[model samples]
Target: MKNIKLTIEYDGRRYLGWQRLGSSDKTIQGKIESVLFQMTGEKIEIIGSGRTDAGTHARGQVANFKTESELSPLEMLNFLNRYLPNDIVIKDVTEMSERFHARYNASGKQYSYYVWNDVIPTAFYRHHSFYVPQELNLEKMEKAAEKLLGTHDFIGFSALKKTKKSTVRKIEEIRIEKNGAMLHFTFIGNGFLHKMIRILTGTLLEIGMGKLDINIIDEVLANKIRQDAGETVPAAGLFLDEVFYE
Candidate 1:
């Protein structure tokens, strides 16, 4: 058997997130797995580094699968791209050790969120970014983001009401930048909870809009209350920027 690794990129507008749902074929995993079945003549399952929410895009998503086929990496890559939809691309394919697992071996990940901070709606970015009409206090938002670094119980920021696993997560970096009318937020961390980035962005946005104070970060961390956090931002603006294995 050969352990095959794949680097993938996809426009997630139409898919039902990254997981394979037996009830629906409109999923990134299902789409790729189907092609793998056709090529290998077996039901091959690909493991992704993480799941991307519906309408959330990915620039450097990674996945791996085990196969008994004799196809080389280039042939597998070419065949996958030829059959998979145009919105989904297999950027690279390579052989890996049998012990390599996409999700378990991942060390860290980078996510980016985009916001159009202008009154004029952008036809081009309408599907790509979230729109906020009010002028945001970039300084205040940056200050709030700084407070979110380090390890903390992010229970309040996650969509999950409860989980057996610990909510504590370490956020290594939070960068907020502006270019033209667009505001960009980049988050790098060991990993993130479900919708944690969206919730974190929503909290910072509230701080930017003067609805929430900078110290609200402290309150959320101490209380661990989900309702006290900011809105779970739209999925359109979120992207899995990259997945790091080393």
Candidate 2:
């Protein structure tokens, strides 16, 4: 058996979330798995490092699958690229030991969110970023983001109703930058609860627009209530930047 690791990039605009739903072929995993099955003539199952919500794009999403095929890594890469949709690309492929599991062995991940901070609409970034017309108070947003840059219980930030697993996560960094009319928010974390980054960005945007107080970050963290946070931003602005194993 050969464990093949694949680094994939995709524009998730037209698909459902990453996971293969019941009989749903419009998912990232389902699409790729179909191609792999056709290529190897085996029922292939691919395990992704994580799931990105619907319409969320990815620059470097990682996944792995075990197969008994004799194809080399380069051949598999080329074959997948030739058969996969144009929006999806196989960036890299490598053979790994059977001990490697994409989701279980992942150590960390980095996500990026883009905001178009401008009064007029942007042609290039129409589908790439969240458009906010009101001028944002960047300084206030930065101050609010600083309060989120450490280990904490993020139950208040997630959209899930309940989970047996712990909600504590370590956020290594939260970088907010501006270029021209674009506002960029980068989050590097050991792990994230579902919709955590989107909720964080929404809360920060509210702070930027004076809808929420800057000190509300502390209140939300202490309260551990989802209602204390702001809107869940659209998935179109979110990108899976990288998945780390080491």
The candidate 1 region of ten consecutive residues with least summed lDDT is 119-128
* Each prediction's TM-score versus the true structure: 0.98, 0.99
Candidate 1's residue-wise lDDT over 123-185, tens digit each? 898887999998799999999998999999999899988889988999999999899988999
Give Cα distance to truth, residue 189, candidate 1, Å: 0.2
Clashes of 1: 0
lDDT of 2 by residue, 71-136 (tens): 999999999999999999999999999899999999999999999998998998878799999989
Q: Candidate 2, residue 102: CA error in Å?
A: 0.7
Return the TM-score for candidate 2, rounded to 2 decimals.
0.99
Reference-based TM-score, model 1: 0.98
Cα lDDT listed for each candidate: 0.94, 0.94
Pairs clashing within candidate 2: none
Worst 10 residues of 2 by lDDT: 119-128
Candidate 1: segments with Cα more than 4 A from true spot: none
Superposed model 2: Cα runs more than 4 Å off: none
